[model samples]
Target: MLIGCHGIPVLPPYIISAIVYGSLFALMSVSLTLTYITTKVPNFAQGALVTAGLYTGFALLSINKINPYESLPLSFLVGGVVALGIYLVVLRPLSRRGAPVISLMIATLAVDIIFVGVFGIYSDYLYQVKKVYDAKLFFALTGADFSLFGVNGVVYTAPIALALITASLYLVLTRTRFGLAMRATVENPNLAKVVGVNTEVIYVTSWFVAGGLAAIAGVFYSFWQGGEPDIGSVLLISMFAGSILGGLKSIYGAVIGGLVVGSSEIVVTTLGAQYIGPWVTPYEPGIPLLVMVITLLVIPGGITSVNWRRLLSRGNGS
Candidate 1:
């Protein structure tokens, strides 16, 4: 009787999709947040890192005779390693030289362009391999599909897994000594170095952690979509949307922002616009980005860092 059907609600496919979408966005937001805090650069290389990781992992998934379930961990490892490589070879050296911020952004953008070109080449190779051989070397990856309390619940396990991951990450960032040092570095690097915190090591560690997390995000996304190439096209919009919506500073806000982008953009725009007519029908994917731009214009700082609460507090003090 606990599973009572008093007023049974139907869960739409778009809703389920948004949940998965948002979860991935949340992960990306975390990566952006990590680089932003530690390196003091927006890390425009982030998108490229994601694409590179996706293609590289997809290559491995295509070749391996082993279970895809097993390959997932290794794919994620490849992603992290790739992210760290970009940091070491590209961003770190430039950052140390006190390079212009715009120059760094452009450099990262160049990295992104290179990644896209390489990814296209790799994708073509995969297509040729899949076509010329005309053979599908099957790899078993875990998935689940079942009713959730009599509702047609079809959620990929990866999204839920990622949510758990964010929780664990939150704990690590908030609780660990390394976490404190990381925060210190963000607040003031020179001071942290003077205090003997080894800011350079922390910088490298930030890349590792963030890159590893981005890889994890990639895996979750791949798992959610059931394959590769989804990372670049689909994730790019939602990831940036979530990070911006989250106010770019608060980890908690990022999670909430991901949910908002996922739910509103996918479910609302897809379904709600259906009733309103075909006028705004095709703007579904763009909604998140539009919202993000509008949001930043309205509150330049972000949702979390907005000083409304502080203003209220001052009023209360008065």
Candidate 2:
């Protein structure tokens, strides 16, 4: 941490934190992108699943007294299971009817409402209630950095982890049958089905996969940010920015969007405080939203949509 001239500031670590935070955003965006891909709907309840993910991580890490790192995987399981239930009870029936856009949006919004209400009840329950888990465990993951592909003075771990996760996802989407089925459903469900694919199964699996990815992101979020219901309420904004940046169509676009959203946030916080000095508190959150709007208005196509096959061919050629 260093200060520039005229009380200007430099905190490289926070920039890295932005990347980590952005990675968390990316994880949620992955789920969001997938939902958009297969169902051709935004899955507005994405934030709800994000909250569920946070709770799952908090449950395993705080309530179960599990080590936070080891407890991480449990969060993904919980996310997947919850998403599966949501699709079965809520989304599947509607999709069967070929629900219209507004209908699907309303349905997912209803799910979001349910999630918010339930989480509120839990928050109240935990409030004057006994702490079943060690609150100390919740505070354990303070500040830290990791070093691979890091500058000598600055270490970057979150971004590195996120990159690894993104790579793994890319491989899955490009190199697997399930991936093809998933994309097939995205391109055209009827056509995919006509070609001997089970579109229904693809959708259900997509929801599960999306929810699970949200959980993985949520776990890191709890690790990165201390877990609480309020955080979940606020996370929707970040997720939305990431999705919009990714063109809301391509998977890799979401990755770039998450990074941009994250970077925009950190940059604003850093520079805003130094220049404006007073409006900092209220202005920070809006930076990404502001950036998102400008980007949408400017680059309509977003981050250049690459045919997955083209990207793969280039990689092989290289």
Candidate 3:
């Protein structure tokens, strides 16, 4: 029941909101899965990349007065650089010294802690020196926006960004030589080295791509929901839930898991508010935790491991 400025119509607010949020979640899940595949690290610092992108977008919009869309590429580069630095300086050296996976994962936790401090300091600086208002958890998506056909810029852009990233990933994984090398390294790093593939380069490239995707998703998310310095930490659970729901091993499964988790989080919360009480909305974040716990108990392998054809046949009694 929404009318556009050009006399066209767009989806209702709730549906549009779900789609936008779900798309961003899907993008993050895919990015996370990619990182896990290549590095065998769950990457707790992934959330910091999102936070970095959020601030990058805020700086671009508030200080530079740049369009949000224009900030995405810059955010991607910033994220890539941060990710590369972590890998090259910290993770790579640890690996060279034969650190275990647990040690590497802990390293990511350290990185996350460091970034939180950096984000907090920057927030203070922006508020005090730059005179930005409430910079810590600043909700900046107020009057600054553009409209497309009949939809807000974010409404169209979020899904489009996800689609482009997905398509590009498919092309890179299937058609590109670098992608082949990456796959080889992920499958068997030792074997890849024996076969002349540079595992170091593949690892670096994977981290870069993962960071870029996380940043892009953060920018899209900030567009619709507004940004906060620690917003990524809050979202880390949902990201993990989606990746786990997807079996944590398959990229395509991550997409399905994210869509399901993201859409259900909103839809179920809305229904809960309607039926249970309005107060249920405040506990919306609990939904992902419940989903993740139930998923681990019922189907640890996740949606990708299900025999969909058999299940459909049983439904038809065939």
Candidate 4:
């Protein structure tokens, strides 16, 4: 049982899990939304880029014995570089040739498949050369965590990281000249280019930022849920759901959408298991899928598209 700072019982494990998962999901979703806004391409390989970060942190921890938190900077760089490479090597050339959006999306899917194979090869290398037998399939390294008031360090760290990242993004986007250029580029690339905004640089910078954010989220996710080669693939659905629910067009919306969907996935699944029996546990992934479907059917434009003020005024009038 976990205790609070004052010795009273803290929230349940499942709730803690929800907070950590939701925070990570929000981070990843924000990254996805940023990429979409800048490039207008739904990066199917976003999950694989995250997995690259997961492996980066995992490799440092498993081999160098470095703390996962300490490995974050390197993970960010690796993820950013890979994502930038993908954009330059694959997407940009295709876009230049006037490839359609669907083709660009397919290219991303192909990249994801390639990443899976690469991760598999790396996993084999870890097992064969490094002798980390569980490199391919491993559980969380919770033993590396320090307890805070009997709660795992991640419980606080995850939310703190999310808060800091979001705040930093808000400042960067609002206060910087580059951010103004980025906004303009996203709004209209040709117009921004005409004004000498260097839209190409903005696109590269945005992809790098998005990849770094996803990788940072990946590092935390490995700490919370364990690292695996295909963990990103497993998480892709939830990330997309969060992005879509948040109204893919708004970065802030992604945050809220991620928190809601991630929390609901865990809480709803746990509740179902408790009340409906263990059989419901296997259907855990369905929760986010259902939420996505319902969101699409009802509010296709997402949470950000809804006019809460008007709705409230109408309620008052009634």
Candidate 5:
């Protein structure tokens, strides 16, 4: 009875999917932007980081019989550790050797391959040791969810999580000393070092934070959409599209970019399938690819490059 009082009308599946996926993509895009700004390397392994989180939630929910939502913090911590390990084992050594940016980027691709291999092994081990079903199987927590205000818990939780994450990131970047140091390090590592900032530590911490956020996004994604070990690879194109659309240099831009990409992916794909023929459904993956190419061609600097002040001034004058 109490739940009934607070019930809000439900939305169409397309709209609901857009909101949920948009929020998740926002978290991922922002994390990728942060990694790019600090490390100057577009970490291809970011999808793998999200997969790591999804697997963490899977273990907690399926094996431990805990609420899937309850696993977020642990997933975040584990993701941070995984990201830090990558830096220590692969990227940091390459950086120390004075590798070019292209080399560093390639190194990230190598890390992605390594993580894919690791996930494959881990999936096998989960089945053999814990009697868990094939970890590569697509699975969702739809049955595990409770409703709120007559909406699927995921519908509300995803947006709420996005708000909290965005607010928290803003505060951390603007109000904290670490944030200041991080910004200094990102702007100019040598200058930051001259000013006594530990650039190496900052870089490591940034990677950890980025990985942690990606993990949280993955947790929500698993709740809304079933996941598998290779799910990250499948989602990587969309994540890259969101990050690139936002202007890889600006974290704030990532929010807008992710929302745009996510919303368009669902809405456009659904509409296409409805009107263009059901056969169009399988081509859904091409949406993000199209967006990426268009963005690169039309706005390589992303939406951030637009001169808002000039546009406003012209409007006022007119």
Candidate 6:
């Protein structure tokens, strides 16, 4: 029911939903991939960090009456602190002790479990103490959203935020001294250390950046979809699927993979429910899993693994 330029009708709610979800997923996938590139450990707690942001924004909204959009900076800081704490307290020590990659990953999973409990406790406190009955579960207040050209505010905000974040990251990574050191550290920590770079500081910075990105994604997610204490855990599979589909090491690939997966998850399900049956709705989560499996089977290296130049040359010759 939205009007486009020239009074044309465009961008139904479902399409807007896809765009917002895809943007947020792309942001999260970039964050997840960044951590993996920096520290060969897959952060299972990434989702929990996202939940932390969700709660932070929710708490501000319910108590202080701060808009979720306005509370994003605080959410980023909180999530960054939590992520940095995990790196410093758990991963750093074990890493120094030469713990295996699997062990480090398991430690992240343990931290994720711990966060679930913490979020649960916080949820209880919010309901009992703050008396926000919907603290345990909540959706975005549509009334608070503005419309432009008949599109919801989030339809503009999510994509714009993703673009800004991506541009900022690109500038930081490719055009700064710290970025040079960080890239060197990522390429080879020992070599970077021997060359006078502080790999530990780079690691800390990467984790903090990753956490902040994930939190920002979470805030957008709450604006696009509803949020709950454990919703991040539920979305963890999708996040991993996006990361894996992107080849896990390429940040740009992660962005593309997330946009593909996120949009398809919602759009495909909606189409199926409209044309096939209602049963398709419940199987939406399977879309990412199926995409992940297909990616693994067809192209283990993911989308970035394909050599576009070679493929184009073949087409020209034909």
| Candidate of highest TM-score | 4
lDDT of each: 0.67, 0.72, 0.84, 0.90, 0.85, 0.88
Residue-level lDDT of model 3, residues 143-190, one tens digit each, is 566776745688777788888888888889889998888888888999
lDDT by residue (tens digit), candidate 2, 131-184: 634332244244321323333211244466568778987897789997888788
Model 5 regions more than 4 Å off: 1-7
Instruction: Quote model 1's TM-score.
Output: 0.81
- CA lDDT, candidate 5, residue 229: 75
Instruction: Tell me which of candidates 3 and 6 scores higher on lDDT.
Output: 6
Please give, for residues 1-318, the per-residue lDDT of candidate 1 as tens digits. 132465655456666677776776777777877777776667666765565544445455556544334555675666677778778898889988989889887887677667667666666666686552311121212232234665322255546666677788778768998878878888898899999898888888778767766776665554445434323555666766777888877677777777787667777777767788666767777888886888789876677877778989999998
Collision pairs in model 2:
246-253
Candidate 6: global Cα-lDDT?
Answer: 0.88
Per-residue error at 65 for model 3, in Å?
A: 1.2
**What TM-score would every model get versus the actual structure?**
0.81, 0.82, 0.93, 0.97, 0.93, 0.96
Q: Give the alpha carbon lDDT tens digit for every residue of 60-123 in model 4.
A: 8889999988888999999999899889999999999999999999999999999999999999
What does the lDDT come to for candidate 2?
A: 0.72
* Number of clashing pairs per prediction, in order: 0, 1, 0, 0, 0, 0
Error of 5 at 110 (Å): 1.6
Off by over 4 Å in 6: 1-8
TM-score of 3: 0.93
- Candidates 1 and 2 compared by TM-score, better number: 2
lDDT of 6 by residue, 164-269 (tens): 9888988898999999998888888889999999888899999998999899888878776768888888889888888999999888889988998899998999
State how far residue 290 of model 5 sits from its true place (Å): 1.4
